[model samples]
Target: MKIDEIDIRQGTANTPQRSHGNCLPYVGVPFGMNYFSVQTNGAAGAWFFQPDSPRFEGIRLTHQPSPWIGDYNHLLLTAIQWDDATQKPDLAGNYRPTEATFNAHHLALFDDHFNVQTDLIPTAYGAALNYDFQQLELAHHGVAIQLPDEGRFEFTATGLKLAVSDYHGGEDQNLTMFFELSIPNFDAENSGYYDAQNHWHTATNGTGKPLTLLLATTAATVACQLATSYVSAEQATLNLQRLQTSTSATLKNESADAWNDYLGRISVRDHHPAVVQTFYTCLYRLFLFPQRCYELDANQQPVHYDTMAKTVKTGRLYTNNGFWDTSKTVYSLFSILAPELLPKFLRGFLTSYQETGFLPRWLAPDERGMMPGNLVDSVIAEAAQKGLATELMPALLAAMQDSDSKSAISERYGRQGSADYDKFGYIPADNYSESVNWTQDYSYSDYCIGQVAQTLDQPAVAEKYWQLSKRYLNLLDPATGFLRPKTSDGKFKPNFVPDRWGTDYTEGSAWQNSYSAFHDIDGLIAAMGGKDRFDAQLTALCNAKPTYHVGGYEMVIHEMSELAAVDYGQLAISNQPSFHLPYLFDYSGHPEKTQVTVKQLRKLFNASTTGFPGDEDNGSMAGWFIFACLGFYPVCPADAEYALGIPAFDQVTLHLADHDLTLTTANNHEHNNFVQSLCVDGEPFDAVTISHQQLMTSARLETRLGLVPNH
Candidate 1:
């Protein structure tokens, strides 16, 4: 199948109360700096672009990672054909979403209310927009540009330049986005600025208003080039210059080629067409985030606006990703398929450390410090173990040590409750919300830091961190077989409710957060009992009721609803906490249970308008689906191995950087999801896990399936 055949809107059907991926129909190249999505209802706040809504507000150039994180540096572009001069310009129209084209590379929408059609295609830092007003009355055809908040606008010789200072907090309060747009030459009298009252003025520039630029053109169609920058207006102009000579057709082709290159990396041959479509669609979503926050100057040197220091700095930087989510799966997938990009991503993290003194936790243009732990350590560890980012690991390891030694002055930068965790060996429940999660995550991150240290040959430092990595054992409760939270006095918090959500856990209960000791699952199992007891507990976890108690939250959060929506018992694949739960059986010598559970989870996902079970959260869920279908999962990012599962596809060929690695399955059917045996290049293999080195070097892996458990 071709890239165009895949709909970018597969997981767009969503709401704040519940999510089907909770994604927007974003039209941009893979990892493009700017994404263009048609906003159907801007008044709905973050839930602005509904897939089925008939209302078409305008096309938005958005830097929104997730609705929960909110948007920054955004604006709306709308085409209008108004005959009246006295009326206020309304940024609303009606359009059929069914007829509109919403592909990854391009977006074309026909507004019936305005009798105009708009086409858009994106480059890395710029995009081309063409408005066709041939069906409108010849008397008037114009454009309305609206900024969500305070903005300054200047009419350029060719078109216009605007700077918006709008954000939903968590960055420099004075943060601004510089934008420039070049359009066909028009009459001087036809363009002006609108005041706060929506009244027009004949001024070349204006500021501090709900600013909207109105431009009337004589031509039947208007072609425009637009670019934005975090640096300055001069850099925005340079960004616009790259697209000056390119047309919509050329840009579309370029974007298509860019997306095809990434999506084509993994080819799956399945009897079901929808399965193939879903695989490619998930692959497309995988590369949309940790967006490029740096741009090039006249000499083509990388420079970025440092939000914390509030100054321009030299180096690559990235934003709009939460490390707690992506560290589990996103970077691991990159290790195999897009290994070439890992070095650059690692450098971005290094630049982040150099500027801010601590690596980012959640970067929406800058650190919001959402979630628990500095999970970017896992990202660095995985890269170092694979030898992808060797030059930067030493500096990054030093930065990790800094985080471990001291806490940050600002709560949004470094480890939370750092001093207490170091003193008590676990974050106390009475001191922090989600203390169990913070302790477990920090313990895993300690393991990751040790991995990087070992790779750098600092054995003493690695041993120190490796020993500290076992801190999760402090929270493990032998009675309930769950990791319970402890008070500041080092005693377990009283009244332990395993099914309670929030409070001591992050987005989940004890059942979901207990087995997160990624580097020490063996220790976790031994603490619980042995392999037999662990296997029984795993079975009980899968067979338990899908219920949740709103313990710490004021209301039922979307994650709780998503957990109850699915029928996988307590194994809530709707969120990141349960990503490795299916593979936990492998450690207990019950690989067949892992295989069956994974096969069952694969059926919940597809390439539909509502594709995902919950918040996709920057390709984390997509990575889970992709890995599960491919028959293995990155159970622990710091480790160099993948726990085996059942493959949904009959054949999958991974086009790696060095060579092709194909995975095939025999007797694989709907009911036959248990692996009886495995072979590597036709030689019998008996292992529950495969290493990164083995997968990269091997050419083919064959698995024979049966209906019953091999055990």
Candidate 2:
């Protein structure tokens, strides 16, 4: 599939009540610093761009990875024609939602009331916007620039230089981004600023207000170039200067080519066109996150604003991602297809550790410290195992140790309840909320740390962390075959209900969170009385009702509702905890069940406006789909292996950095969901897991599926 064929709006039909992927129709290059989305309702707050809404407020400059995380340094640009004194300050024009283009690299919308057609083509740091208003009877046309918070703008020789300071919640509360906009044919005498209440100021420059720029132009078509930076206004100008010579056609073509380079890496041959579309759309999503926060200065050196230090620093930095989500799937995909980019991502993360004392958990410009565990450990460990960013492994290992040694003073950094976990071998439920997840995740993170340590030839350090990795064993309730919460006294907490949600677990019950022993599935199976019992428990989990008790959350969060909405029983694939549940069957020597279960889950996804099962966090869900569709999954990132499953398509070709790896399925039909046999490079293969080395080196994987189980 080509980049132009992708709608980029898959999984965008979302709301606060429920999430159908919770994704935005973003227009930008892959991993671009900025993204532009059409804002339909500004008053909707985080839920601003609903697909069905007829109101076209403007094109929004958004850095919003998720609605829950909100946006930072955002601005809106709207085009207007005749002004009404009695109307509100911000005007909403009508547009055909179905007619507007929501392509991956470009956006085009026509405002009916204003008689204006707007086109936006995005670059890495900025975008070119063309406004055509020839149909309007009035000669004077205006462009309104809206800022979410207090901002300043100065009229320049080209157009205007604007700066806005805004953030949702992070270590850097006062994050700001500078903007340089070039409008060659604007009327300086009529152009000015305005407040929210129709209070207009006739001045070339303004400061310390929630200012909105109203630039008037008599020209029928207005061409505007916008560039932004976190460093300074001068840097923003430099960013704009790079693209000044490029036209709309060139910008659009360049953006398309950039997206095609990444999206074209995977080519699928499926009989169903929808399957091909879903594959490419999901693939497109896998590259949108961990946006580049660093920008090049005048000397073409990477520099970024250190939000913590309140100054510009020399190095790469990235933001708008949570390690808790991405570590599960995103980095593993990167290791396979985009290994070249991993080193820079890790280096940027290392810079985060240097600026702050701890490695980042959730970073939106800076650490927001959301979720449990420092799962960047998984990213580092996987990258180390794959030989990515090898030069930085030593420093990355030290950063992991620093974060593990002590509890963070602020809630915005490091692992919560780290001291308690170290003392009790488990996070005590009496003191902490979601203690079960905290303990389990920390244990997995320790295993990851140990993986990195062993790779660096630090045997003693590796041994120490590997032992600590078994802390999940401390919380296992052997009787129920679940990892339950324990008090500081080493006794299981009373009133143990496996169906209960949120008191001890992160976002799930024991059924979903119990099998998180990623690095030690054998140990988990052994603790549950070996493979038979483990298999029985997993079977029961899938067949059981998706019932829940709102224990701590006191309400049915969207996850719970989504779980019940799907018919997968207790396997809540809507959230991250259950992402590897089906693959646990692989550990029990039941790859047939894994194959069937995975194929069943594929029914929940498609290529449409509402495509996903739930909130697709920072490419994590998309990454999961990508791996599963290719007949394997990264069940454990710390270990360098993928659990094999049934393929979703007839053929999938992965164009890796050094080589091409292809997977083709035989007798591929919806009913033939269980793998009958498999071969690697024309040799018979019999394994539940395939190594990273084998996948990267092998030429082809052929899977033969049948209606019945092989056993």
- For all predictions, the C-alpha RMSD in Å is 1.2, 1.2
lDDT of 2 by residue, 1-711 (tens): 778898888998888878889999989998889999999887888889889888998999999999999988999999887554223354678899889898978899899978899999999999999999858765457788888787988997768998998875665677789999988677887788777665777788987656677888777789999999999989998999998889989999999998888888888888978877888899999989899999998889999999888999999999989988999999999888888889999999999999998898998878888899889999999999988899999999999999888876887877787888889999999999889888888999899999999999999999999999998999998899999989899899998899999989988999999999999999999988999999999999999999999889899888888888888989998889999999999999888889999989988888887899988999999988887798899999989889998898888889987778889999998789789889999999999999999989999999899999979
On residues 354-393, what C-alpha lDDT tens digit does candidate 1 reach at each position?
8878887998888888998889989988888888878888
Candidate 2, residue 41: Cα displacement in angstroms equals: 1.1
Model 2 segments more than 4 A misplaced? 84-90
